[model samples]
Target: MEKVRLGIIGLGAEGGMYAGFLTDGKVNNMVLGAICDIDPLKRTMAVEKYPEIPFYEDYIQMMDSGEVDAIVTCVPHYLHPQMGIEALKRGVHALVEKPAGVYTKQVRELNEFASTKPELTFGIFFNQRTNSLYQTLKKLIEDGEIGAIRRTNWMITTWWRPQGYYDQSEWRATWGGEGGGVLVNQAPHQLDLMQWICGMPAKVYSKVKYGYQRDIAVEDEVTAMFEYENGATGVFVTCTHDVLGTDRFEILGDKGKIVVDGSRKLTIKRLARPESEMSSSMSMQDVMKIFMGHSGNDIYTEEVLEFNDAFGIQHISVMENFAANIIDGTPLIAPGSDGIRGVRLANAIHLSSWLGKEIEVPFDEELFLAELNKRIVAENKYPVNA
Candidate 1:
């Protein structure tokens, strides 16, 4: 009971990474207990690599065997909730991977189920939340360092994937497999961060392109506009085709503005007075003088912060935090309930694009599911190149 015996339920790229690290004892409070995968090759690989650990072709069997105190799902988007529910059903702590699930309905189901099992710790692998850069930004917003948020804009196009990437798996980019492309796969972290740092938008209107640059069936490019409940507006743009992609996130507030580029470098500009106050109080002459840089430097303060690459460390931190939460009474960095926010936002974006109109938060779940089913049916009827 001192250390958590963690079972990993997939041997894909992410699952493999967790297997390597958890087996290597990267997290002091967590040890690799068992590995499970439906793929025979992956099971063989797990056996060859970690012969001491049990290999189960069925996740249910692993959970039923009492070999693992907790389980982390590294499966596809759709299986996350299904497997997580199974883990929680057996009174095992569960840590789900990103995006929660392909849709909110399932994720909400998982959350509702987890709500009943309050004794068990349920968390999601929002590893980016462990990054100091985003942590600082979240605190700044919460602490009102930037007054109230006025606008947010993030353009993250660093997920450049070639055709071979999709060709490797039949379900790589199809609607029936990965759900959506950039938004569902490569951009979930940013989506989670956006809603986490700046509260979820009340409305979202998005223009999405399906397989624009890739040979996939789902969206590969997306541009979404958001309207907050407080009348603040925001924009989110992401795509997977930009080889020289840019990653810039900007949040403007009444008192200051925060900008992050490449997910590491942070820049903050603080104003002596709120923009609302300045707009109402400043005379034309005073504004002109300030605009001319005569007193702008004195009125504004700028700070630049840089963060080292903590990509691997972030994942380790999430795992350790999950274990710590189970071993002690520590709070989770990213609670399993919080995973639905990103999925809901992503659904809004997809629904907005599908309807070619602005969709409100907590939009019609039934309608979205119906529309998604149409695409899923089509994707299955006429499969993609992969």
Candidate 2:
């Protein structure tokens, strides 16, 4: 197949954005063949606006209709793996949105299933991974430009949502419907990028606040601390209600520091000497001088690189790479298997918060599912307004 014929499930906000690009041929060698949505209004709009393209209320029918060679699912958090499995059953390629599933159980199942289908191209919409800045950061860290990493922190709270926004959809912020709040929704990009850049943490401890900034049944504020295998530490903080929020990702290593001040630009500071070498020469008297409030400023050098809004470009690049991989047998920048890491990270955080303790990576999946099930059952007492 020289050109990919793509079908989209879920004609909501995100799905519609993709449809616009496909409809207008934003990328090369790809055609938008079909769209699926259960809503009558969305189906009607698709039929009226893009009458040439096929429409289906049922995804199964769309998959079997032979209108598309691949499928991209933009459904609810829980439905991603489900629909992707169905797409695979149809012998079609699949690309799913972020936060692979509501919990690790579903994600593990999805990844295991995809692992059996070696012929199909399974991709994830981890669009942020396509950003050049993140690519540079990954390369720098992988190259040991900053030596051994000591600490990592992210304050990604730029997302702002009001109570009225949650009222618009039944699955906006409910544990049963949306799974969680800021972490699952706005923070997945950052979380995915975090693990992608700094490597996954060995353990996580989180303090989560449910509806602290709004009237919802899920957490809108979160602070999580992480411990790495190499004794490196991390902190992740996010909230959906912060005004003038910041998006700063800073990582410190034995050699220097790197910062991705997403609001403005990305920069790196290179140290003159390896921290191990510098500290080896220091005595207890040097420690006393630093303890007595003495510090030096000429420790490192700074370098700023070109940074730009990665919004639309990264999205298009994911689709482009997915097609390229399907056609030319290229490696994926963000494969479907890679998505499970972010899901596991989110699950570990929610589980840590629920259990009120430090949880290790590869935590008890059954326990996490049970805790989620308990909260899902409590959704009855706090029904969605819609």
Candidate 3:
């Protein structure tokens, strides 16, 4: 087996986490060939952790060196599309972090670039897809255990970030650096999960607040209503202000309801069993007992193991998929094209809040881009002088 040589850019929080996986030999069949970070301290820290691997200050120089087969970009939200596009142009597979880009146009460009290079793989890391509970939920839905989901709701408030956390990095909360607050940063996984399970929305109405929790310019609290194409309604509520928070997803269907409260494990209330199997006469108590027995466990471990099995253990599954697609013709888990949905939805929410209107889906990309650029330019006026 030819080991895949991997390079990593942006040694921030999630970057370091991926680096740890590579260095710890948790992921197999991949070598950490090189690492790059603009920060001198981060570069030094990475060198210290993996002495065999070379470090570079400039990612372009690292890419030019021709030392890596794939690049894991854990850079800021705005940089994901550019870096990923550059990697594909260079014939290097790219695995980018979530909320792939700041705007829809950039994502479309990246996807078009990747499409032209069919040999190149491009993947976005929406790691929550690996969670066991989520997998089970998806499976149940797919299996028609919940008949035609009519309504869904997710309250994701567990992403509490303190003032010090945002203060630690100049790019943390600012629009110019990170794009948006909880929606762009922390809630991409949740958004991706929603899209994965419930599919895209046809219409959206949102209310967003910036200083609801902290003094940041981007929204910290959001309540968005979604009308799915199938006439199913959904509500997404997220906040970084809640000190005592909860992450919950509930799907209400004609036949039953599936509720996943991040704290209380997973629960399913089946209104009625399948007619074909009704002869079993398993009472509601028995059904509840069975459901409880099979509910939440440490699914994260399972996700990691699956990632290891599919792609080399050291490689992130999404990145591995990208590499495989390039090298051996595999499919992308979350392609660059699929990456824009969350950010588009987030932007719609922001736009709706700003304009005081219910933003329609399949929004005007040019208009949104211009508005976002204007907001970024305005915010950058008093840039964080880190």
Candidate 4:
């Protein structure tokens, strides 16, 4: 009970990162308990590197080994839910990685199972949730700093991965393996942040390009439109092929607007009065001044917010919070159940693109899965040997 012994399932890129964090003592109140990987090379590497910690090829054995009080699922997109379920069944706290799963249906199953284990801490690696910029923006929206959102747009295409990146692993961009391309891998954080701040959209319409730049079968470029229940609308654009891409997210409300660039600089402009009222009551002369850029200080207040070097804090804070929640009842920053929101949004985007029409927020899971299976079957027909 002194410190949570954490076992990591998968020693790939993400698992290795978590292992490094734990072994480096970057996360407090937690220590590396065990490691698991089906790859013999990873198992050998882990054994040689961390001789004190037990390494297992079978994750189930690691969970049942009584060495770990909690576990983090750092495996593939599809395995996240199933591995989490297995950990929960063994009474171990579970923290999952992003997107929850390949689809909403599987993630729902995990969440439904986790609901019965209230005694255990269940969380997701929505590390971006710990970012101060998004946190402040969420608060501003919730506190009515920007009235109801009129429109929101985010163009986050800084996730530029070369073809070799996908070629490094067989499961990198395959439908049955990684599930999808940019949406599933690179843009989940933005998807989570969008809904976290502005709430989930009522409908989604998208235009997607499959393997447009890369040699993969899944989408590599996408531009999606969102319609909210409150008459608010949003646009989300992302691709992994941009070399010098943009990372700008803007949310415009009736009374104010918020703009974030590169996830670092944040600017908020609060109007002197709501745009609705201003449009109705402003004189022609005042409008002329505003149009001519003569109305300066009296129009609205501007504030810029920035947090330095929070990249490390994002992941470390999430890990520490997960441990603290298990230790002293601290609430999770990103609950495992909340993981489904991002998946749902991603699924909606993919479905909209596939169906060539607007898809409802709670889209048809059966239809989505059926379409997904078709692609998976085609992918498996000529599987890449990684």
lDDT on C-alpha atoms for all candidate structures: 0.91, 0.88, 0.76, 0.91
Report model 3's TM-score to 2 decimal places. 0.85
- For residues 1-386, what per-residue lDDT tens digits would candidate 1 score against the true structure? 79999999998899899988888878889999999999999878888899999999999999999899999999889889999999999999999999899888889899999999999999999999999999999999999988999999999999999889889988788777888888889999999999999999999999999979887888889999999999999999999899999999999999999999998899999999999988898889888888788866556799999999645899999999999999997999999999999999999999999999999999998888888888988866433311
Candidates' RMSD to native: 2.4, 3.0, 6.6, 2.2
TM-score of 1: 0.97
lDDT at position 299, candidate 3: 12
lDDT at position 307, candidate 3? 15
Please give, for residues 1-386, the per-residue lDDT of candidate 2 as tens digits. 98899999999889999999888888686789899999999988999889999999999999999999999998888889899898888899999998888787787788899989999999999998888888889999999989899999999888888788889998789887888888888889889999999999999999999979899988899999999999999999999898788899999999999988864577888877888886888678766765775644444677998678546888888999999999998899999998889989998999999999999998998888778878887877443211
- Number of the top TM-score candidate: 4
lDDT of 2: 0.88
Candidate 4 wrong stretches, greater than 4 Å: 381-386
For model 4, residues 279-382, the per-residue Cα lDDT tens digits are 99999999999899999977889999886654477888999999999999998889999999999999999999998999998988988988888888786643
Clashing pairs in 4: none
Q: Native-vs-model 4 lDDT?
A: 0.91
Q: Backbone collision count in every prediction? A: 0, 0, 4, 0
Name the regions of candidate 3 deviating beyond 4 angstroms. 273-327, 382-386
